[model samples]
Target: MSTVISHRLSLLEDTNDQLKQQLESLFEIGERNEQRFVWLKELVLELLITENTNQLDRTLYSKLSELENIDDVLLFIFVTKPKVKLKHIRDTSLSEVPSRLVSLSKTICEVCRANEYRSIFNVSIDSSGSFALIPYQFKDIQGVLAIGSSEPARFAGRVDTLFLDFLGEVVARVVSRIS
Candidate 1:
C-alpha cells in the first residue's frame, strides 16, 4: 500500500510539471505576439510620416490598411488657424468624403459630449455642429484625422490615449514637413 501511494504522488507531480511547462510555452508565445504588434505599430507610424505628396496617397493608404487593419485613412489638413477649416480631405482611395468635418477643443465633441473621440485611431469632428472653438492648442497646425465608421461605439472613451497621442505627433511632424 505504501509503495502504491508513493507512485500515485509521483504521477501527480509529473502532471503538474507538464502543465507548468505548457504554461511557460504559452507565456513565451504571448510575449512574442506582443513584440510583433509593437513592431507593426512602429512600421505604420513610419509609413504615415514618411509617405508624403499627393501621388503617394494610395500607397500610404494601402500600407496603412495592411499594417493596422483599419477600414480607411483620411488625412484632413486645417490650413486656417483658430477655427481651422479643412483645407484638404484626402482619403485612401482619393474619393470625396462627404461627411461633416470639424476639430474639437478636446477629444469630446461639445454638443454630442460623447467621449468616443479616439484621438489615435479615430478623430472625428461633429458634422451637424458648427465649427466650434478647439479648446486645445492650434499653433501646432495639425488637422485631426477622424476615423469614420457606421458603428458608433467602436472608439468609445474607455480606450487608452497613448498610442493615439503618438500618431498625433506623427501627423504634426508630417504637416510641418509638407508646409
Candidate 2:
C-alpha cells in the first residue's frame, strides 16, 4: 500500500512541476507584452506632438533606429488633392507603387522576395533578409512605411504585426495633423 502511495505521490509531483513551468512561461510572456505596450505608448506620444513633416520624419527615424533588427526605414506618401510638399518625406504617384502595397491596409512582412520588393522603395535592398511594408491611410494622408532588417527571421511570416499596425496608425495621425 505504501508503494502505491509513493507512485501516486511521484505522479502528483510531476504534474506540479509541469504546472509551475507553465506559470513561469506565462509570466515571462506577460512581462514582454507589458514592455511592448509601454514602448508603443511612448512612441505614440512622441508622434502626436510632431508639428511638422521634418519633425515627424526625425521622430520615426530615431525611434526605429533604436531597434536592433530594423536596419532601414522609408516613407512614401501618395500625392493627394492638396499635395503635401515635405523635404524630408518622399512623394510618389499612386500608379508608381505596386498594387499589392496599394491594396493592403495592413503590414506584410517576410523574407526578401526580390521581385515584388525591388521597386517599392525605388532603392535596392538586395542584401536585406526581411522587410515590412506597412500601409496606412487617414483622410488626406495615405502612404506606405517600409522597414528592413538584416535578420532573415526578424520580420518573418510568424512575427506579430499588431505593433506594426499601431505604428502605421500613429504615422497617419501625425501626418493628418501636420499636413
Judging by lDDT against the true structure, name the best candidate.
Answer: 2
Clashing pairs in 2: none
TM-score of 1: 0.47
Candidate 2 lDDT, 1-179, residue by residue in tens: 99999999999999999999999999999998898788778878898788987887788878887777777677878874435444336767778657766787678989886544465545555564788888999998898888877678888999888889889988888878887
Stretches > 4 Å off in candidate 1? 1-51, 67-69, 81-140, 149-154
TM-score per candidate, chains pooled: 0.47, 0.85
- Ten-residue stretch with the least lDDT total in model 2: 80-89
Per-residue lDDT of 67 in model 1 = 37
